[model samples]
Target: MAQEYGYRWGHSGLTADFDLDGDTPRLVRLARPGDHDLKGAVEAALPLVDVVLLGDGTGWSGPRFTGTALGPRLRHRAHHATYGDGWHHLTVELQDPASRLAVFVEYSSPDGVPVLRSRVRLRNDGAAPVTVRSVSSLLLGALPSPDVLDVHRARNDWLAECRWYAEDVRESVPDLGREFHGHDGRAGLRLAGRGSWPTDGHLAMGAFTDRTDGRCWAWQIESASSWLWEAGEADHHTYLSLGGPTADDHQWRHVLGPGEEFASEFAALALGDGFDGALAALTSYRRLIRRPHPDHEHLPVVFNDYMNTLMGDPTTRKLLPLIDAAAKAGAEYFCVDAGWYDDEGGEEDGSGAGGWWDSVGGWLPSARRFPGGLRAVLDRVRERGMVPGLWLEPEVVGVRSPVAAELPDAAFLRHEGGTRVTEQGRHQLDLTHPAARAHLDATVDRLVGELGVGYLKLDYNITTSAPGHLAHSRAWLAWLSSVLDRHPGLVLENCASGGLRMDGASLAVTQLQSTSDQQDPLRYPPIAAAAPTAVPPEQGAVWAYPQPDFTDAEIAFTLGSALLGRVHLSGHLDRMTLSQLGLVQEAVAVYKSLRGDLRTSVPFWPLGLPGWTDEWVALGLRAPVAGATYLTVWRRGGGVAELLLPVPHLAGLGDVRVEVLHPSTAAPGAGRAEWRGEGVRVRLGEAPAVLLVRITAGG
Candidate 1:
């Protein structure tokens, strides 16, 4: 194949003429059969969305798009047409389903000019390298993506045809009969028209925008035998980009030599995160979620039992001493977990789980151990100058519980024998259902009203299982909000086994979650290290993995991460030895001392992505009005990292002093003072990280 069709408005590929004769689009001299007028057709098709501001497909009038009969401006490609060392196959095909769909595809440059040289390459007969490029498109009749601008190039647009070799086509559909039909929006490549195969989604039309290279341009990609063209820029738009994995479509195949064929073939890409607007839009959304509510009284840090391994504490009085220690250490709330129930068997009590049921289950404290009950514990907590907190596994219901007995058919996803199964634990209540809410409502009342607990740690062990579903998060919010309204002064600390359901929506109901259940001092830092990568530093990576399993030094370092978010504390002080208790006191002291600095800084993930070595360096900067530049790095791994602090759009702090606060063994994660203008450089030797507390002075 040498050269095919090159029809242009002014150049080769396509020809565009004004609607001289009654606006019907004139053709001076036609070469093909059909006379056409497909100029400015993009504007007519998707009138709502425009090309980028640079070029918006404005200078229309180009190729006359038609089917069956060849139009005056038909475009195709040919490669090595005159050479002998070539195997070429020319096939004219119709790519439309029924009479209702139309196709409008084209090729564009950064300037919004269509790619004119329509060249389809045919190379070496037996697996030889071929310089291939595909420049083509098909526009839908009237599907409009309103917010998009035409400045986008081939990549981030709607659709594209992946470039392929002779061995790429599974089985060519040679000459296909064409039957024109009515009009359908997805006009790109008609699935049933050529291959008679079903498509993933109705693809209307695709176009182009940005024309820069690499970060902003489109290029065809091939690894071994597959061909995929990267099109569509995902800035300010939110479309699912095919990035890491293969797509669901199995339509593509590589035509290998002889009996070899291509299967597992599909094009994948990365799409934008979708857009609402500017950063202001994000701020507004945040404001709505973190709105000040009198109903949500500040609940203090909860001292948990699981990580502390203090569950079923036979010597219950041991917990009292720990409670006193924590109270002295400045904890505003103390909660007793599972073992303090009325049922002997409920939690090592051997009293049997008689009270726990589907209807009002997990409502009672283990009665046998806490023969004194949850109320007595609350009274003790209050005497220590802290609001009493209680832990409740709200989303789960045990089959042997009384609450489960009362819940109706819709309350939980049930089976024959009242056995409810779900993600976190047994009997997951479908919060989206009304009956589920009612069950949760009654349970919350018993805990909030009867138990007199001012704080609640809602436990959800199951990660959500609904796929492609949007209602779960909001339904969860409704449950939390209802609880808030009932208690009116309770702080709902969220926990799902560990940080499972932590996302944008979860933030709306509760402030923090027990980041990880293990809280092994050795384990906490690794997870905390990855927090910065997933979320901004301003938000809480406040994971509470400080099990009795950690050394004192580890505990202190883990608490330092509180600057990133709320630090959850779990463990009983009663069981800790004197030295361990002293360590907790010291760590708590430092956290309180640095609260102001930690609250104001913006955390950044600088030295590349957080790797699996349980190590990540986090940097946060606080530049409010006139203040010291404070930064913290939680390095889980000990390595000499080139500490490159990222200061993308951060302003102010022109000249400031910096210093590292800890560590004598390794270089300071924060030590010494340096006035290095806005950008301060430092070396954080093998130590986890260097904490930089900057102070500015000038009149």
Candidate 2:
């Protein structure tokens, strides 16, 4: 072990350090990497005192109890243990003897993977209950601040989502003057998620890059509800703090009775050489934390009749031909999207105008829509060698739905005044109630076990208020866990409007995530390119909507976008000519060949993170297999036709070969591509064109 400033670094790169000495242990470095070599500065810059003011006019922080005979101070020592697969568990225990309040700071790190997972647990041993107003999941004393640092964050909207931006940290928070005592003043930036949809306003992720050293640290809060992270400079060191559910943000307050304990959600931290390296580490860490599912390996292509295709109105007549076309295009799952459960109008007269949203909860097959019954359409899907699936918004009931009247008020989310909270013409269900759980359980059982449905596209369209949001999230997790446990083969697709609930907590339970609901093919490349930043490549379902009206180049561009991620096939394939359909078939074949690689691949950007309207954007997936990489390049209107893409990972490999593996119509040499020094030179003749290049070494 290497020791400095009372901090010790173990062989596994974990560093154990405290915020202040001679005080109850307030762990600031839990599993922090030892190679950083900034221990002295970090220790010296530790805050003299940390406190949270309570309603009783007492300051509570760092696991100590107030108004106690132990003089309001607690002391702790570090302990460690080893588990399976070189996993290390480090614990720091602090206790207020007089008040009998104990707090444990836990850190878990596995060998080889550069991730430090931290969570806090509080236990009350006193006879009286103790209330915790705030507790941080992680508190880091210092982060590298090499001359220039860039702070990165993701902005999300309804259709235009996962747009990332990087800004100079100093520009956002002007430097505190460097005086004789160095920078004593503090400046900070706080990013947070507010409600049920943890990713509604922004992603629960952040990164800081030290330009001088090319070093970066990235972190994400694995939470389904509210979360907050703050980066600040105090004294001469920078501190990063992360946590979930606070009284101020989520109206979260926990009372720990005698011998009772509460644990906070885990916060993951990673370190790397640059933004790419950090992202790679985070991606690997994400894989480690996700619940293993066979779908991750199978990576089936799904055809959902939404997006620019059916737009939610699907009848037997409208779906039969689409089903045939989808299977012909190599899709393995055919999902009849929304409007499958509507009962307000008959299929012949239904226009899906005002009744779709308000008539939700019945979940019964529409008699008029599926004249031969919904099972008939599903049977056709199975006969075409595809799995049958249906879209469901399970957590809500339309106010006008008959099921809403049948279920008790306790089954739905209600305000303090006993009135149910409704949004977007739907009433949210509170899964914590048994009746609600039973209803959803029966729905899944019927759809999967009885109907032979192999997949479910679960969607949530509205947000709930405060405590209800957190409660609903927990309930949803429980219900999903039960469903998945009962039917291990059933695949679940999570969506909220579109990409709103795309957080780690929900993603862990679902097999795939819809990247967005953006309809325009021209505006989808950026979203598809940036999705890996928020979700794993195999789980990000990008839509490939090819219609007869689109130019051949446009078809390739749209189809090529989904080649790099999970293909959410859509569009008017049933109405397309055989030639147009051939292009879709070619793209699907290419994706099938590459889908296996996607399971073990991590994303990299040759052009860096994409802008909403960038002329030329490129995304590369570097496979774990030696000398193998898949590159997707797009040249939009008005952009340069020729560009050089640097592939640092393939730099030392000998004699690289690149080939266009999609769109059989593109001539053998439609686009000029050659392996140059440390990169590939790609030249396209026209705008709005794309190339899915398979690159390998040993040519």
Candidate 3:
């Protein structure tokens, strides 16, 4: 397949080619196509090099692959976006610093498609970018029906469907929550089957546009999301910078230079089983490549379920004191949890469906509860100096909502077979449907623009629980990304029934997530321990202090949440012992000091293993500025008789001083050093923790 402007397309499963500007780069296959890997592509689409590959093809969603025509040295990673034009979208500019460029992909479903997903950037920063060379192919599997080939829009009873796509939105509010919000369209592309991939059976297309930019480039192939790579060892590796989209997926960015032109050749792999099957498949694909993108690192952010609390004068006043007490103790923001505005009002009043799809339009302050409206309460909290926030389940809606009765053809996902109640009171919001987005966009515009809300936490409490729903990973993740694009400054937390949605893709957008609903301090131990062990700490931001069990040990362990993400306070605030308060304050101070260093650096290990049995766990901070680490070894079953401290990264054994801090008893401990040319061996025992105190070279 050849399009004008040196873009030619080809796909034969395992390998494919894109003859862009005369140079042809082959895109090889990485693994066999599967449901999981393709789901991840729809979910995250993060850019990364294929340094690592999952051994068993079971976990990855599609047959993953990376393009190495440019090589890591040349840096050719990039993202693309097609407009409401369906599969084909245009790229806009976000940031173009020096040799690095940021492209914005935009789309809107004013037309008839169900879900719209697009990519967004390509950076060129080097001495000079050379001739751009790339190949586009998808890892695929045969899905042989023309009917199945054309994926349309459908809705379950829970909500209506809408046509929406990613874009470089140009909407602005004179005063965000008080003025207005909207999106600016860029370019769109129509869908035309270009070809099929080699290794796995899939389809493909090229990007050709007639916009003002006058840039028309031809590209090839859309295979199954699973078979992204095949054969050519170096060319097709799973790597690229991910700019937009949402959820736990990979997105990458690249810097091309003099002689290096920005080029992105992609293979589109299509699979259908809806979101759940997609997610299960995505889970595996994410497990394959562990590269870190820009958004993946942070200061351990978290979610506080306070935003949906008081939307009026009465409840706002009640929450003021609680908000003040919590914010001051090292908390970031407190999202008001459910029950604002006629939240639970009634079917006739938009209250009966208070959970997922309930809409509190007008920020309706329950006349019975707050009479003064939500604005007044927000003002009081601001006066007290804390960031105020709220929650909204944009995907679900209730049957009797005043707005529901007046909308256009709304899309919805209904209860599956074997179900008795067709009217579960609420319906899911079909973000993929055009009509649905118009309603949701307007709804959020009013709540956010009219109301002075700063943080918005969107929770999708049900994933696996519902079947036969429009529950694919791309649909929801796309919705989440669109929300973020609309409100870039707001912090969104992921709440899928108390951390049920803690995965790679969701973790991408929900910078912070609620680990569990059970705020009981007792339950925090086993659950919390597995988090740091199961996944990297960056995604697990914010573990709240589940009340009533606020003991000194709890405070120390509560700090454990720090290892996962941010520390959240969920206990009954009014009932705290003075000692408990003091202890929490101390832990916060200690956590604050270590956070900066923790967020940006990689986890270094002398033991190389984590969360296993040890006198303690040792970690090394590789950052030059904050170049030190803290190892915490809890007193184990035999009682930490000794600690085996290792300084494998240190240059010399003789120049460091190890400070011993004992727990329970101060019998004192010793620091012994051994000389090793490349590194050092430092040992300590009896001390709860041996703070590796390195002395200055001059001193």
Candidate 4:
């Protein structure tokens, strides 16, 4: 709203005029409400189809539900409105003239954040059931710019995630060249994801920036299942269409009985001056939509013994000293990672038969690993003023575990032939079944009530590729909600082979997200620095694993990786010398001091989006409080000694004060910083070093 574009809405339809960084306003129209003038207006305005509902029928664009097809004729029924501080909500109902199908489109936008979100709900009103094949959550139509546009999207996998790229839209789809000449054929780029894991192949997000003007628009889908988004040029206009599962993508066909309704996942659209502006708006939107939790306000530091520490093999002797060291370093929650429940072997044994994945279920403490019982270790953690936590893969039953035979077949997910689906020596559990739900409930209750455990690191290591997996995810979330309702004090950490399952549906219920499982310190800066692009800064947990062998500068670099996000401490703390341990303590102290400001801050990249092997990566969290901004800068490999960081928000301010909040003394020859124009220039003496700088306005 700050950059006015002549946007307006009414009962008939909504229309907006894009500025395009010029005085003239280019008109763009949304779908009209009623059918009275729909045919005429749709032809004149070239409106993009917002909601695509597929059925066994034909339409103007060929097959009713296939690629870029217009399925049905919808007429607007009614409209409603609601407004609140920094937000507005609008809902419009549309009904098909021939069928009993009706679609309700809901749109909400916050004044503070430049984002517009939309979701669609399909209902059956006729006496017979309706087989609904597809529904889109969002669609936007815009007149094509005079110049070409570049499309941007991110690719995600297990270890290498959040990698982004941009290219000419025409290059990807050659048909776009024809659109420029007078050929109006349907042509554009389609990006989508299928099956249980929402972000397995391609992330459910996209963005486009005009080559002529700097204006940009980005969209993200918040769904736990299959989804798709298309950017196409047709009739001389470029449009963006996105939505949840479709029959073609996921074999998803739902039967809606009379009076039954189904709602699609939420999709959001953000408009800004450039990629950074769009990213900033998206960051604010994620915060606004997330469920409120007390843990967000507390911002406690968590120490997990998984990366570069115990490495998924924990025992009583190994944990006791590490627990005390973590407490001394100011860790509030001490999570004992995997291998805590292995009874087949003792520590130092590496037989594949005794691996953690093959012996998962039953959730019992290994007597061999904990000779004095797991409770003793947890009690020690509590005595040290830290909460006790455990690692759990609740969604899977090890193929070799006794629980696999104990639970009925109904408790496990099955394939088309009634055969149980197994992945990586594990069978997926169907939480919708009462037996499965009860088993998990008892496991959690016993751990919390008897062992005095206060936190759970819920991890998922398998992907459900068969049909009907969505039911299991929904049931899992429901079970989590019920547990939270019963025991509000228990905190949950969500992880999936380290961030494979990081999505809106799961993040809404869990307290924190483990950003990645990358182990090497040098290769982790990009993932840590770019985490805010997807997850909220306060909820993103980045590992700061400072070990004993690391140099002073290396320790600072590892610790600074988590300065802008939640500090997840790890590494061989018990092996560190007193001097090295003191440095770790100092970093924790600095993080605790800035935790409060992190909750209300918006993230910005002073240096453009970081590449995987960038020598220098910087992330800034600008707090709403005037003259306050927290910066985390990392110097990796070889680069220039001096770097200039732009602060657009504080550009006009005459003078500013900048100071290092961590690493009390810079490495020898690391030059001081000074305000230069609209940015700050700083010099660091060596690679593999870090600095946490705080910038404030000066009188």
Candidate 5:
């Protein structure tokens, strides 16, 4: 065995050092190769694994570890390392003498990728059982103090999502003169989430960068529900702890019997030069971990007749014309959104409010809406050179739905004892139940086998927070993977009331993510520009709905929102004039030509990340191998006519060419772009206008 003093593990582009000289091994250094080594500068007193049990409460009364006694008593036992499939896996086992709990801090990282995935495993070696209250998937101490670090977190909500804001860490966790008190403060910044909608209130990611230097670190917790992350001062040094469900916050308790083992959720961390660099690394890591799909490569443009068009009320008459228009507009997939399965003929006014909300679980086409059978509409979609799709919310059964009564009570999620969990008159399906999984499998198989649904917009509109959310979440992903495994050709789009459940876990299994439900043409720019921060560009499905009454500028503004990401083309194209429709067609064409590079490209913000109400916003996709860069700039109601977007990569390269790729004929007050010193200067004379530009080196 290696000496129990200092140990180092080095792999592709990553270096980790542990201080085994102490009673408990401490992860003193973790960084990119040749980066700063965090040792001696700060004490290696923090434990590599932090755990909180039912009776062994924290040593300190805070979200961090100062109060955790078990953490300090966890002595180094043994470690094993292995490599397989271009990934390095390391598990360090530690034993708490008093509790006789064997904790394994497991870590895995892809070769040459500056990203690490962490999780914890626990095996009870004691005579009696122990209840685990909370455990950290990854915890790091001795981070740069708040004086030199600025924390970055995104504010998320219904339509407003991925809005990032940066603040000085000192402001959030001020210096409390702990030297005088000899103890860490009891307060810190905590970003947490519960319920079924993981990203309902906030995203499961955060970052911190040095104020002077560009060094930065970012991390994301991969959990569908009930997760907590906190950054606080421990022994005067900053510490970050990330974990899944906890008893204190989510009423999650796991009883580990003798010899029983349990594993926590996975969390990933990456390091880069700055926010953009870190996010780019994270973007690459997201691509690495996601399920492989042809849709990611082809990036087929989907036209959903819901937002700003049919509004979920679909019928044979209403969809036939739209299908033809969508085909003409270059959409490769046509998805008939919600209300397609409304067998209960209530009121059909284009707005899906009548029987659509509470009477949902049959997954059958409406005979009344489709008098000639839904196949005729689907056939029309296929004839238009587009694949057919349907909307489904498989995790819920409406109170009045026949399937709700047909399935046994055990099929639905419930409280710890027995009561079923209901949200908004809908019972949540627990995929952990074999019966629930079978029901969903049957529904999906029927849709794909019988109706020839090549695509499915799997939406979850209800939120439930019953006990056993962690297990149910894992089973849900397993069920989704199993469905995809069986129906290999079927593409799934993950949507939860628009970006509510946008997490790495869901995106890893589903092919596409609906970025938002924002209907207004003017309000989508910010969301579109920052979507790639949480989702890969090719996987982020952004809606572009252009109405007939919209001006040329309005049409370009909305369509430009999706050019850099997956084109979720919506709107009443059938009603649009030829001139108005031409713009949509041109934008779709531009997306197709650019999408091939998006899968391999990395996103960058020439002008720092956009603000919620920023007058101007820009999103860039740089394909290094292709030697091309695409920029989509939106000028939304501002007096500033010119934007100097810095493209550092193109800086100092002589004779660069900038071309407006969209809006074939510019509007009356059109936008213009040209090569400047180190960036492109885009001038848009009109408000609410957008331009898609291609930049390349030229003679």
Candidate 6:
């Protein structure tokens, strides 16, 4: 399709229309190929690059934004691209003649994925310096109006991460009635995250859908630092913009010297028929962008002695039995959680009273805790046919740690006024500094090479606020890549006090992500079900802690939470009875049988994106090639024993067959499933129970 005023390029599974006829080359449409042309639906004109210079302000009369003024004045210079390795890259050049400030909009996408990744680069071409306040990685118009569109967002926090909610666009940005007012509304809904914990306040993702038509657009800002996104009415239609840390939202600013360039963090967008479709597309894109690792494909079971089991107080005597039990349960990796380096015998056993909280940083095993050296425990792990793993929070040095004093002050992230920044009794390490990077490299090399450790649970516990967080974040990502390059086989788990740094930039380089530190088995369903929205199922490590005291239903409930994703098994299996251990073994056996499908399957929520306190929740994984569908349903204390869970995608198959994989029918209150019209009705006699069922078509 050719545009009369500009050009329309539809290739490699995506469509992008540019209005080159104007002084500024605007992205008129970004959607699926052969889809409806948005040229007629575009109610407002928006520049492809939303940038704010030092002097130039908003062109509109309402909220300050990077939509107009300097953006609209940028003249199109050239456009080019490259292609290889199942990926396509395109770059559009735009420059401001007055200030000699040049902007480059870069876009990339996988061969067949319905998602586009975008970013912006700014350069100073003039002799004078150019100060930039804000720049958007992606900006687009022609979205559905508030009257017919609904927006979905997630509020993230420790233990309660990935809590999704929906609201009408009018709820956030009131219906200004642009037609009657004779102008677009300036006010919009702005969502942002500050500090090093990128997802501490809210997720760097959002989606909007047409209620009647089910058309949806979902997006994620792939930044490990501060980010901001906004949506509002523009020219009768809504527009959405994504960006990294901005001057107004995060106290970030940069003065680009002559011939200097700066790149914004990447953002991705996916279009689909509904929320599930968009999320499934996003899942595929996530898999394509992440670093390739055997762990993602094998989907190994990790037994970490944290959460409700060890609680970060690892010792040889405490871990040996657990290691044996985990090996018997079919866990491929055994991880010794925190407190491994606590030389001081703090008063508390599993509590923070044990210098474990404030006196960290020396990645060494404590002789006092591990009587025969940590090597003995590690050797036992290997002897039991499991890889040894250790936990390390490499980004921070405790105030009481000697490493803090050994490294120079410049190695730590400092405030704008040159003061060392501290949070939660730890000083943040600035990976941009050579000394800090060296220290981390040494720590990891010793853990992997010297101690024969195969896996490392890299954690970031503190949230430090400082200027230039975006730059620091990029440096951190580079360092992570370097480590993986040197130790190609070593596995790294990206954890930030449990899912705080759950962003694409971080997930792209790490093998696994801790979905949450939520301890309660009952409260973990929503997090586990929604984690695929931010991460691929293979990379989202969901904890399944089944204790000896738990009943058969309780055990099934905990283990079922992680059946569809990467299983991070915890709990004191060492003390469980034969029957209890059998239950745990049964769950692991089922997981291993179907783990291969996780790498290729896309996620769907039959119960709709779960609510925090919803009584019932359902997550479906459908493998397109295998012609198989697996569903995990959790019933959290509701009287409803039967649920008619919708599975429209699988309903097309004429004959559907169901099988209960876990807690076989012989078990008390075993759940069963049967296909019905457009869905399957699952039944569990108990209120607090879980069921894992597999359905096949044309049986």
Q: Assess the local accuracy of residue 684 in candidate 1 as a C-alpha lDDT between 0 and 100.
A: 49
CA displacement after TM-score superposition, residue 238 of candidate 4 (Å): 1.9
Per-candidate TM-scores read 0.55, 0.93, 0.50, 0.90, 0.97, 0.97
Candidate 5 or 3, higher TM-score: 5
lDDT for each of the candidates? 0.38, 0.78, 0.37, 0.76, 0.86, 0.86
TM-score order, best first, reads 6, 5, 2, 4, 1, 3
Query: Clashing residue pairs, candidate 5?
Result: 58-67, 59-67, 59-68, 60-67
Runs in model 2 deviating more than 4 A are: 5-22, 26-34, 44-74, 97-99, 178-186, 625-627, 665-669
**TM-score, structure 4 vs. true:** 0.90
- Tens-digit per-residue lDDT, 424-523, candidate 2: 8888888889999998888889889888999999988888764556667877887887898999999999998889888888888889998899988888
Candidate with better TM-score, 1 vs 2: 2
Off by over 4 Å in 1: 1-284, 294-302, 311-315, 342-360, 414-425, 432-434, 463-473, 529-541, 544-552, 575-583, 593-601, 614-616, 621-629, 637-654, 659-699
Runs of candidate 6 exceeding 4 Å displacement: 179-181, 346-353
Give the alpha carbon lDDT tens digit for every residue of 1-699 in model 4: 322333444221222322222221122443222212212222223322344445444333532232233323555566567777657777766666666677787778776456778888888887888776777777665534313778888877777667777888877555546535655444467787775667776667888887766666778888766778876654445667778777766777677889998887788887676787777778778877776678989989999998988887788888889999999999999999888898776553433125667768999998878888889999999999999999998989999999999999889999878889898899989888999999999999999988888899998877876666766777888899898887788889888877676777777788898788888888888888877877888999899999999987788889989988989999999999998999899999999988998888878888877888789888888887584887778888775488888988888787688888777664553435677878878777678777788888965
TM-score of 2: 0.93
lDDT of 1 at 117: 15
lDDT of 1 by residue, 1-699 (tens): 111112223223122222222211121221111323223332232210111111112223322112112121222221112112221111221111211111122212111111111111112233422211121221112111212222221111011111011110102111121223222121221121011001111111122212121111111111111122222211112111111011112122122242222111111111111110111122222323343554223323455554555553422444567668778666766766544543534443333333332233556565555556656667777888877766677767766566666777566654446545443235666677887787778777877788778767766543323221123344666678777766667777656545544333455556554444544454444345444322223344364434456555554465555534454555655566776666566555545555554434433434422333435555454444455545555555666654445443333544344554432223223333344444545554454443434444453
Local error of candidate 6 at 516, Å? 0.9
Candidate 6 residues 1-699, lDDT tens each? 467536766465687777876766777777786566544554365788888888887787556565657888889998887878988888899999988999999998888778989999999999999888889999887766677889999999999999889999888777776668877667788999887899997889999998978988999999999999988877767788998888887888899999999999899999888999998889899989888988887888999999898887777767889999999999999999888888776222433326667778877788778778889999999999999999989888888999989999999889978889888788888988999999999999898998999999998888866975677788999998999899998999999989999998999999999999999998999999999988989899999999999988899889999999999999999999989999989999999999988898899999898999998888999988547898988889866478888888776778778888976778977888888868888888777888888888873
Better of 1 and 3 by TM-score: 1
What TM-score quantifies how close candidate 6 is to the native fold? 0.97
